[model samples]
Target: MTVNGRRVPVLSAEGVTVRIGGRVLLDAVDLDVHAGEVLALVGPNGAGKSTLLGVIAGDTQPDRGRTVLDGTDLRRWRLGDLARRRALLTQANSVAFPFTVREVVAMGRAPWASLPEGDDDEAIIEESLAATDTTHLHSRTFPTLSGGEKARASLSRALAQRAGVLLLDEPTAAVDLRHQEIVLELARTVADGGGAVVVVLHDLELAAAWSDRLVMISDGRIRAAGPPHQVLTAELVEEVYRQPVLVHRHPVTGDLLVTPDRRGSRPTRTPVAPAAGAALDSAFVKEFS
Candidate 1:
């Protein structure tokens, strides 16, 4: 039922390398994105995480390798064929014209135009807007949105694409605390539904919390890649980032937690027991979820 203990990757980048203006952006990078899994790409700034994602998205061609989607090389697919199979969310989502948020999300349905899939366009658009919490902003012009609003609106468009593989670059970069969890939860739901999601995140703990696997890159190469528990050790974090960090389990959820050492500059206190906040948590979950 599996290929070598895993399902065949829906998208794969093999021996991928990229050079821009004589600088090596990525060097011999290899990545696999499998269905039913969320893969988080994490690293410090300018660590080729985005470059690797672009290669996977077919937006940036590799200098020395090939990218495959569903067992075929990406270059072989037509533009609309490729768009219908995967969706990409970049750092900036700008529309030159004053298109309404509804119109912007509608653009995602273009790939399926003239096909049977086009019949479900309206229902899908509504679902995507609700998923990103952008349903209320549908009538607003894209150019007038705030940073967080624009980010969520852009996410709605990508979701509307209904692609099997989702590539997100810093999807949570402009969101607030609550929306950050929402964005990652959306990514998790996509993977759970048998799609593949590759998200680039700067928040190490969030990446560890949401992803089935973490791929850490630095200086144009992968430094570590594995399940969060196996790859997010304090030694590796400090080594790759050259910054003092403390790694431990969350007090309540037991998820991995990563934080800066701070050189003992702050006072420490005992954490409250989980039972103390159970009632309030239940109320919130019951109301929201």
Candidate 2:
């Protein structure tokens, strides 16, 4: 269960905070990502979803608190060493060079350049491409691929990294519906194979459908963190997202299913903040009044 050369507690954040121009982007946030689990970060736009991913990936330093990989601080790990242990697939990846898909995926091995694991690297790269269902485009130019295709290619590259911990920021943003499901399924398979996977997802349905745990964030803090059924309640969803939602058990899987009541016509109730000392505004009071 060790990840990135560290023990089983692959990723941990304690009182983590990030600020940009005096505005708190993430405040006092604590999270843990363990091996063989898919932890989904779900929130509305500007909820610091990507910022949190950057912090975990060692791309952005937090203003306060600590992020640890295994038992060591994230800063202690060299960039190249960190890259070898964790792979981050961001939302804004673009290929300026017209490298073929295979070449692009092979770049993931740069961290292990001096290692004499040639055959293992090649097998992993090929498996990554096939897992992402981009094997057919192996010889295609990266710059010439469609948006969705490019997304899959980037994902394949991350997979090729063969890192024990994987962080994805909006991994399905540019892909079509089918590709979205495919990529999420691949993430699930990776977690099933004993890697730690953290994905920032905007689609609630997809998050509920695939994630083993859910971390809901709002206004620079974690609103709820637990299994999907406990955290993604109807009232909490409406409070954090400002949209009425219905929570039900999926008929087939019996997992929690969150459906937005867009019209807001349902008989809804106000949400009670989970923690003491958390503020409760008049609007919430009026809703339940």
lDDT of 1 by residue, 81-149 (tens): 999999999998888999999999999999999999999999999999999899999999999999999
Please give me the total number of clashing residue pairs in predicted model 2: 0
The superposed Cα distance between candidate 1 and the true structure at residue 166, in angstroms, equals 0.5
Model 2 over residues 1-289: C-alpha lDDT tens digits?
Answer: 5558855677998889999999999999998999999999999999988999899888999999989997799999988889888999999879889899999999887788878754588888999898889999999999899888988999999988889899998999889998999999989998999999999999888898899999999988999998888888899999999988888987988867788776757668776666632445555777898
Clashes of each: 0, 0
How many clashing residue pairs are found in candidate 1?
0
Q: Per-residue error at 170 for model 1, in Å?
A: 0.4
Clashing pairs in 1: none
